[model samples]
Target: MKVLIVDDNQKALVIAKARLGKEELDVLCASSGKDCLEMVRKTTPDLILLDLDMPDMSGFEVCKILKSDNDLSMIPIIFLTATDDTTNRINGLDLGAVDYVTKPFDPFELRARVRAALRTKQLQDQLAELNRNLEDRVEQRTVEINQLLNQKDAFINQLSHDLRTPLTPLVALLPMVLKKIEDTEIKKILDLAIKNVGYMKNLTEKTLQLAQLNSSRLQLKMEKVDLKDEIIDTLDSLSSIFSEHGVKIVNNINSPIQVEIDKVLIKELVHNLISNSVKYMKDEGGITIDGFQNSKDVRISITDTGIGMTHDQLNHIFEEFYKADNARHDRSSSGLGLSICKRIIEKHGGSIYAESQGVNEGTTVHFTIPL
Candidate 1:
């Protein structure tokens, strides 16, 4: 560090020069406040010790002038005076002097304060540097995330448009050819082939929806919607699936609850959860859709007595293409249903999570939307 000491007495200057002879410091001497200010602009010392009583200008005056300049304001200043008047010392400090030292100075105490001031300045500089670095890192990561999202959008578009187009013709032709077939063995094979194609179609649609959500392409048509009606309509759409699996719905939501939401998206969100419950279910099970409102949000839960997930499975159920161990090899899954549902809920400024009492017990999915 470089320290600049100013004094009107030549003897006092000599004494300071001898005391501040420690290593790693370059000391500069000024005979008056004017000379100190001038040397400061050129030398830009890290710390300054100024005599409070000078010929023309007091140290308080010098402190004010230094602090007024933005470039010099951060430099630490300490006052040196012969009088031990508490008011005068406080006056110097009020003008922004970092510390005060009485004249006929104690060398050890001056050195200690100097070291403390320098250490404090070091920490401040380090913190400022860290803030600058953090800002730069955040900006860089934002650019990278944007680039990745753009590439994901392009990939999903190609998957939906280019790929699904070819599969559509094959799917349509396979069904028509099956209509003309008479052999049971051949018909079964064609039906199996059609099922695989249907899975592919479902996968493509889910990918498109997820990609659109990630790209922020979906705009919500926000309106006050009848929550009960939406749930009933969504369940009605999937009634055939539930009937096929022998899954009865126990809708505990008795009253109508009004909510601000996008009707289409919220319906889809409900449909996905209910369908998942019925999809993995065996014969003779029940699915429940219950809702209630709190002060800040309206909460809903879907509980099902189906093939519940293990802790490991529950952890990854919301992730893309993450099927539980039981359903990992099930070719019917696009592995994107829950992921799409999660994205939809998040878009509405809501949250969703799942809980399970291990495998074969039950699973409950809960979600909340702001009121």
Candidate 2:
């Protein structure tokens, strides 16, 4: 422990330093308030023995200054004064002095008080360190909980979408088999039921995929892939859908960029973007697929001339189950397509973002994957 003995009386300072100095402690002495303040600024003592009456500055003023400044506030101060009045003790305590000892002090009592003050300071310092550690642990736990919740939501959505995909064939076949011998009214009711079942199945599958993607469990079998070849393959797979929707597929991927990624996941990403473009187009909009390679990354963009989003809508377009207010009325979608795209991109250690010039203008989705 480091202790500072401050008093105008040189004899008293010597007496206290001699009595308290020990093998485990180092002692420093100051004969005036100015000298004490300078010593404190130079090296902060763990404990201070201050005198109440002084020529220039009272011990009360010194205590007040030490307590007011955050840097010096924790140094334990014990006052040594000749007066032992109740009001004087109260005033010292109010000024943040920890204890008071009378002048012509007993050496044993002074040593005991010094030990007590040092012990209290140690305990207080330990408690403060413990509180800081506890706060750090709480912050870490909060971050972990938030991550888990996001994963849970993603899983539920993926399960629902996957289960719904196989139901499509059943919905169509069941009603056809039962309709042959039914009357016109019965057939009409069956048709309505079949239609609703198909809708439900589509919704379920999309929701499940969204959930799985968001959970960070969407794994990919990675391989070295040529960007041009992959784009051509994806467009070929969706040629029929494009024709039916009267939408044009324009490819400008001139660069022969090679990257390591999951081919199947990339296919799914392209399919979703193309499908969204067709679904939202008012007048047979075209989709442009393009890519370029920079020094450290490959950039891919999907631009569409469809019903684009507002700035606010673009901000949250990738949030799972987050359907725009306007999009909610369109029963054909379950609002998980873009979120799935985002998850797939992120799983590849990439980033995706959308930009639009408001509704009915156009939208461009850009992503960057590290090489």
Candidate 3:
């Protein structure tokens, strides 16, 4: 470490220098306050021993000037003064001096004070270096995560495109060919082929949608909308499907219940929940939709008069590709519907859960979004 000692008394400067040099420090001397400022700027010593009394400028004035400069402020200053007044000590400390030393001081005490200040400075420098390294590591990890998400999206897009290219023509041409066929066995075989082809196309579209939702790149288009109206519109779009399954939907949500949300995603969420409930319901069963608002959020629920789940089944229902034993053989289910619904609720900054009393009872799906 380097130490700079400033004093108008040449004898005192020489005595202080010899005492500190015994500690194996590189020592420099300045005869006046002006010389001290110039030497500090040039050498940037780690510690400064300043004499308060001087003919040209007081040590307090030199200390103030150094503290004002951002580059020189942190060099620890210790006022070496002959005057032992309490006010003088307070003023020196207030001007950013680290410690105060009396003239004709003990050489042992002076060396000890110098060591303590330098040790503190060393620890501070190490901490600052560690913080910089931590910031760099966080930035690098963010870049790697972004790269992986982009690669996943690219792979999903290509796969969907390949699957759809063949299924599209098969879906359009198979029905036309069936209309011209006369043999009953061949006709039944063609019908089964058409159904399988349609299922594959549906699976491809849903898989791509789920992958996009899972990515960080998806951005929601937020708007203020009526919750009841949105549900009614979704029900209207799927009215024919519900009728074929002998199910009834009773929407009990009131009008003027406004919320800020992404309209398209919410519609998809309601559609999936209702369709899943219908698939598990008894013949001519009913689905009741209801919602209400509290201080912080709006809670909406869809209750189905369908076969309820066991505790073990409820735990894994929202997970991707998870299906109950009964639904495992159902060809219409892709096992991704409820998973997509869960993602949609998460994207809206909300919570979703399912409640079932017991087997053969009923099930209710509840979700909450910010008001």
Query: In TM-score terms, which candidate is top?
Result: 3
lDDT (tens digit, per residue) of candidate 3 on 1-371? 89999999999999999899888899999999999999999999989999999988999999999999999998999999897889999999999999988989899999898889778777866887898999999899989988988888888888878988888799999999999999999999999999888777777877888888888889999999998889999999989988998888888886667899999999999999998888899888889999989889998999999999999999999999898999886668888898899999999999999999989788999999888
At residue 46, give the lDDT of candidate 3: 88
The ten-residue window of minimal lDDT in model 3 covers 120-129
lDDT of 1 by residue, 1-371 (tens): 89999999999998987888873679899999999999999999989999989979878888899999999998989889789999988888888988988988899988888888888778877897999999999999999988987887778777778988898798789999999999999999999999888888888788877878766656888999889989998888888888888889999998988899988988988988888888877888999989979889998999999889889888898999987766777877889989988998898899999999988898999988888
Considering every candidate listed, which one attains the maximal lDDT? 3
TM-score of each: 0.76, 0.58, 0.86
Backbone N/Cα/C clashes per model: 0, 12, 0
Candidate 3: give the clashing pairs. none
**lDDT on C-alpha atoms for all candidate structures:** 0.88, 0.84, 0.91
**Candidate 2 residue runs with Cα over 4 Å from true position:** 1-173, 176-182, 216-220, 324-327
- Cα lDDT tens digits, model 2, 144-250, are 98888777776575666567557857876877666574587877777777767766776777766666665644567899988778878888988898888888878
Lowest lDDT 10-mer window, candidate 1?
A: 209-218
